[model samples]
Target chain A: MARKILRGIPVSAGISIGKAYFVNRQKERRIPRETIPHHLVAIETQRLRNAVEEVRQGFMDARARVPEELKEHGAIIDSHLMICQDPKLVESAAKNIEERAITAEWALERSINAIGKAFSAIDDPYIRERMQDVRVVGDKIMQALIGTPKPVDLPAGRRVLMAHDLTPADAIELELSKIMSFATAEGGKTSHTGILARSLQIPAIVGVEDLEDSIRDGDLVIIDALKGLIFIDPSEDELAHYGDRKYQFEDYQKAIVKQCHLPAETVDGYRLEVCANIELAEELVQVKDNGGEGVGLYRTEYAFFNKSNMPDEEKLYEEYATLAEQLAPQKVILRTLDVGADKLLDEQAMLDEANPALGLRGIRFCLRYQNVFRMQLRAMLRASVHGNVAIMFPMISGLKELRQARFVLNSVKSELDAEGVAYNPDIPVGIMIELPSAVMIADTLAREVDFFSIGTNDLIQYSLGIDRTNKHVSYLYQPLHPAIVRSIKFVIDAAHKEGIEASVCGEVASDPYCVPILMGMRVDGISIAPQAIPGIKRVIRQIDMEECIELLGDVLTHATVSRINTKVRKRIFKRFPEELSFFASLIEQDDITEP
Target chain B: MEPSGENNSLEVVVCVENELGLHARPAGKVAQLAQSFQADIALCVADQRADAKSILDILSLAAPQGTEICIKASGCDASEALEQIGQLFHDKFEGDT
Candidate 1:
């Protein structure tokens, strides 16, 4: 009989069935603080140096293997190289070895902590995030010193990689064609390993504890990343079933890839617009390939975060213009730098924010410094001339902030007009209905803006008083809560009442359970990660508007979140049994790790 | 302020005006400049001090925007070293004016 399926948090989406290849990194954990004999110190130090060279050489090899299009990621490899070659790290390791008589792995840990102590007093969240980068560097070096094999070079056969944990540096340089998927016992969905797997379209599952103990080498593993489940040693019937399903999935995916160029309408002829939310310009190709009709959310802060110098209007214009021209006729909603909180800025006001989520951030931060805001507005305006573009403001609490933003946008527009810049003078302006206050007064605010796009992530956070970054309170950040559905209903109803479109650009928009409910809500559009386009569209095309509306009605009538959640899941899964089954692992995943 | 003549050293304090503060990339630049000068250089944030030329040490300072850091140097190039590091902050470590 097949062993009971192991459930884990799904980090990336896909399906793979292959022989298991286990990579044990347990030694790094087992001897975190080991002591060395005094005489062995020299040998340990030499070992550390050799490990550094080996890791450094690995980076050099990885860099050489990286394709030209992915050269932007070469900067990450370079950062790792800098950490490996850093003299302080090397010297500190040597010092710890000679003085404390510790193992190289133990020495590296102590050295990292000793360095981390200096950053303890610093208040900048952005700088604080760098502490993790240092930790990653330390771990990478230790992995090298331990001579852990990455299994990067897999033979041309179906293979499933099982690791205790995998880093970006280990995963990025592989010739990924041979490897079918990845399952790890550790890492979050947004970890570099998970993100890289998604970008490469590789099937990946993380947080699968004790995978090495149960799953042996050469075991046939079925990785259903969509549902975040991996089936081990399946029966012959299951294999045959999966074999047919895999074939259909690939053919369906290929068909959907071609459908990007087609209109995102339902089989019943219900035309619902689907767009892409992009972090960088390189993703434009992915967006296009995924059949995105337009750019929904252009995260401008990424451009600001990556550079040392303040991103001037010209630089912003060039970047925005490139995106606009590429997706001409398709609208690009450029959100002005939504910095603060996790994202840091060079400005004092942003730094001074004690609670960035509720402080001088988003639209509030923009209004604080109109000159900086003006430059961004000017750049956005300039880019609009190149193609169809729209402006959206983040974290709009009330009409006052929205009006204030429009006033500044108008001023920038006037300045452009005087300068004889040709732009879409009547470019559509929108507001992200993310705040609870905005949801309450959506009727009032909807009358003022061109459109309303619901940002469910922050909306839920503020509504439930959940600090998503705080893991303890994260369970409270429920997307299917009765409150969220009602809020979404309010905003969409208000937008419809005002004769404007309402769109969902949050994580929930792409969720299978949320999709039918959103479609039932009669949302004009949904914007999601490019990779999710096909799967979501497949769900959208399968259901009728009447059933969706009925499902929404059933869900909203319930008082508790769990009640509504169960109802929505049952209704949607009934319509998409195969599709939801594909993503079933994540559904069975007891609790969402995301805040 | 003029250089202190005590042991031919110089001590000066300057606030980081850069919006991103002195992060890793800019810290790298500062560390490189510190290595070029022939002086006993150190940067102090509050009571903590980091060897000016070590990138890891400088980054550990975690000097956010508007953090006033103290630089102390004693050598023939004390004043010169202080001025250059101070100027990097003043210019926001933005390569071009």
Candidate 2:
């Protein structure tokens, strides 16, 4: 019999065959804000408190079922419960309800909204995510007082969870063992739920449009995570074919792991460095596991963000030092505070602008707040004492910013000297060639800095005049645009001409299909997310640099993005037909099998 | 706690015993205490924070383990906060041992 198939957003890395289990999106009901009678306020408050208690019991039960590894997160829920029961929140809601003669639900909702809005306004994603914790607390209180349905547990048995979005709390509460895979109707690959799925190594797909109504529970499903394909209700022949392919894919992944320690060299003998772009210190494990040469780009902003206050120098130093030590001998290139108009430092630092991407951010913010900049510089410098730590400044427009940054570095050195603390005075400094102006003056900046790392994500965005963060303009943010490629080539050539090392540490570097083009550009290194390292290296090892260089030379002359992309893809397929054929064969084999 | 010294120029150097040192939680506590004092309080760790009043300045000190820090406050309330801050060090800043 012919089988039916469904498509979904691909999030995680592997394929799984499971029964369809729909994770119903919890409906959010907005409570009225009007006040209620005084006597009823006391009654409603008691009712809300009782409801919160019930939800707390449910949370405890959920925690009991979670694996021992995830018990610490349970503490976070406990703290959230505390916030729900906080005398401050309770009393304020009670007072508001009594004075305004509002329903207990309305008063509680208003109080929670105030707290959630306040948390959301903070400049940290970690802390901002805590706003959801506040919502969970309110949801519990509302459920208790207003009789809202309790959050249901994940469906039992092997299945692929389909949902609109899964919060961190929601993800933590899921029975992971029973979940074969997950597909979210909405969410980017960097969302907390996405990260959690990746960490759990579950097959997941995100950003699928209208995925909820298309599939129903108990439907047979096939998820091809590697290719970002989902098949629902397939023929028996297709299922058997995919089952064999899934087994082969698992073997291939194992082979990559075994080859992790091997050099990333093309068939003809050109070697390349495959490094990882690490966001959190804990992610360092993945880098090492993947046999990354070192941290190509350590995003340090995550450490300082999502906090109640600025991370003091010592705290920053310790975190940096730990990463440096862990990657000892291997270099850790730290990109300094990249916050800009999009990410405000505090409410006081807010500059409401029509466009934030072009506004003051990156090194510009550092220059304006010399003290804050100095603290980061000092921390980075201090951390250098532990291992090979290099510093890179972001968003340089011209020579003035680089010179001023150097001046600050010198002043920090003098301070460290006077204080009798040992620091590496000769620590290498680099600049991110993201801005068009930076690329234009790359030769000059290369002369001033120790190295250059092209942030293709921003380079493509700025070169194309597209704001990557803006959903409306996201469609235009193509990395293969010849103009963007030329801009990258210009900076790479400039850095080389000045005898400075250069590398690409953006989303483009992580793409397997783009590895040949990057190699042809003759960039010194490629830094990508840890998970992409092995696959990227595998692609890198299959092609000759000379052929890649020839392909790049031909593609560079193309005028349009589609033309450039077509030429690149054609050259890649022509040069590595075997690899392309393998991938195609895997696509043809449509069965899901357990690894 | 009050400083025993009669001289307003008295200064004491102490080591931060807390695992996080004088990070946000401790720094905020110190800043709050400093606000109460009428003295021109300056915290010096290493060569930084020499002309302090800036929380950012004190933080840049990056004083870690085995590091010595000096707390100097010069007015009437200076002695009180300084004494309390010094005692905090002696008390190990309520740190886990």
Candidate 3:
């Protein structure tokens, strides 16, 4: 039979073959709502109480079942339990049952909706977020009342998830090993689900309309996210063809994994340190297996953001210590809590700034809460004793902010010293050159810091004044923008002149096209997704530094993003055609949509 | 009949300091702390009131950062309850600014 190929935006890149698991949220088993007879209202109210208690117990059990590394998120479950235990919430739901002679499910929904209405009526964004909590609690209670299990029943083996849409939390809660990839019927390239998929390096195709209608559970399919095609019941020839491609891809990944053990060097013999940016310590194996020299950017905010209550000193230390001990002599650069944009904060704190990406975030936020900043600094200092550790601050725009952060670090160091806590006295501190102000003042700022990690993603965003998250403007959020390249080169040159190391970590680090441009610009190191380590390293190994520099010089003079974008792709396609698919991931969406 | 003991009321206006303004973590902290008090605690933002003891309720108040919320506590431990809550806001719910 001829292969039937469906297309969508390839939000994440890879290829996978599996039986489909079609999940439509609107079609799920929900507790049916029927009004109870007035006499049976008492029983309905009692049922509501029992269900709440039972679901709260379920949350506790689920918390205990979460892996130890993710135990920090237990506090979130605890808060969920608190919602269940809230008398005001329970009494309101019970009141619905008693007064309206309604079923428990209907009463609970009514109660939660009433709360949601009140929340929405308020102008506060923080209070509006509470609507989701009520919805979550309502979901749990509904599950209890209906005697249903947790959503998304995973098969014993690998299966592709075909959902109408999936939230970031739901995606995180999924069994990553059992799911091959995601084929969602809605969402665009910058969806929260898309971001999560890319971070997890899962192959996903989003915005495939009528996907549920076209395919059912147990249907065999091949998801070619690289080409944004799903081969439905592929022909034997097509299956064999995709089968070969799959092995080649797996073989390529294995080669990349092996490259981790090899020293990352350019053909001209310049050694470049390829580091892995990780969220959890458990990813250390990938860092090691992928030949990462050390942890370049440890997002420490996961510990703080995942919990209801901020983790205490000891809890933060345990994670830091584990990371230090595991990586040992190789340095771990922990970016202290970049938590303003996209990072969950309380509603009250979220006000004042209409635009989050440009608002009071990153270093601006940390400096405001000096105590919390000091605690993190103290923990890093305490952990440095176990291994080589450094501190890097994100979204720093000025020398004053850098000095203020340094002051907090100094205060913490003095506290540790007075307490006689043995910590490395010479832990290096660096600043991420993510803002245009940081780039313009790189020389002055470079004199004060140990290194600069040009966070190209944010640098691109802030430089172009494009909201990378907004789909309408995302097309303009290009890494190949002349201003972006020059800004990065400027930062690297400033860092080099100051006798400090410079690196690039962000979407640019993983992009095959950006790697050449960055290496050519003479960045000392690159930290990227663990899986992308080998592909980037392999590309670096193939090129001489002089050739890359020459190529960069050619593109830097180009006046437009498209001119630079066209020239770079032409250079890669002309020189290294075998790796065409590597650049395709970043460029694919624009091609199919544009002329 | 509510079990809030010893009728007394205490009220204070406090600004939310934490960034992300009264989002989940701070709201959860507010709910957690409110549960420990014997008084009935209610938080009002923009004249919209939410039961302080409920995460869902406090979250519903949706006061942005810098929002001056009025925390009202009634019954036996009202003063103590208000003081602790006011302190949390002063400390920015112990969340980074």
Give the number of the best model, judged by lDDT: 3
Task: Give the per-residue lDDT digits (tens) of candidate 1, residues A1-595.
Answer: 3574776657677778888875555542333345667889889999999888887898889888888999878866765666666767878888988999888877887788877776666677777777776777777788777565544545567678887877654564455676789998876543446655765677898877678667866778887776666788987876786778778777767866765566766777888999987767888988888878788888888667556678888898999999999899888998887875555577844367667778888998899989889999999988888998999999999989999999999998899889898878888999999889999999999889999999887888889997654434544657878888899998999999999999999878878888878888899999987887877887777777888888888887899877776777776767778766555322334543210
By TM-score rank, best first, the candidates go 3, 2, 1
**How large is the i-RMS for each model, in angstroms?**
2.1, 10.5, 2.1
For TM-score, the strongest prediction is 3
True-contact fraction per candidate equals 0.48, 0.00, 0.76
Worst 10 residues of 3 chain A by lDDT: A586-595
lDDT of 3 by residue, A1-595 (tens): 4345677767776889888885555636434445567989888888999999888888889988988899778877877888888876799999889888888877887788787777778776645665676788888788788676566567688889888777665676678778889888877655556656766777898877668668756778988877777878878887787788878777767766675577878888988999988887877887777778898999887787556788888999999999999998898999987877666556316575777777768988788777778888888899999999999999999999999999888888888889889998888999999999999999999999999998887888788887765545667768887788889899899999999999998778877877888888888999887767777788888888898888898997889877787888788767667665533445435675310
Candidate numbers sorted by DockQ from highest down: 3, 1, 2
Q: Give the worst 10-residue stretch by lDDT in candidate 2 chain A.
A: A584-593
RMSD (Å) of each candidate, 1 decimal: 16.6, 23.0, 16.6
Model 2: residue A384 alpha-carbon error in angstroms: 0.5
DockQ (C-alpha based) per candidate is 0.29, 0.01, 0.37
List A-chain TM-scores for all predictions: 0.69, 0.71, 0.76
The superposed Cα distance between candidate 1 and the true structure at residue A377, in angstroms, equals 0.6
Native-structure RMSD, model 2: 23.0
Where does candidate 2 stray beyond 4 Å? A1-12, A18-142, A145-182, A187-202, A212-221, A231-242, A306-309, A340-354, A469-473, A577-595, B1-97
Report residue A258 deviation for candidate 1 (angstroms): 4.5
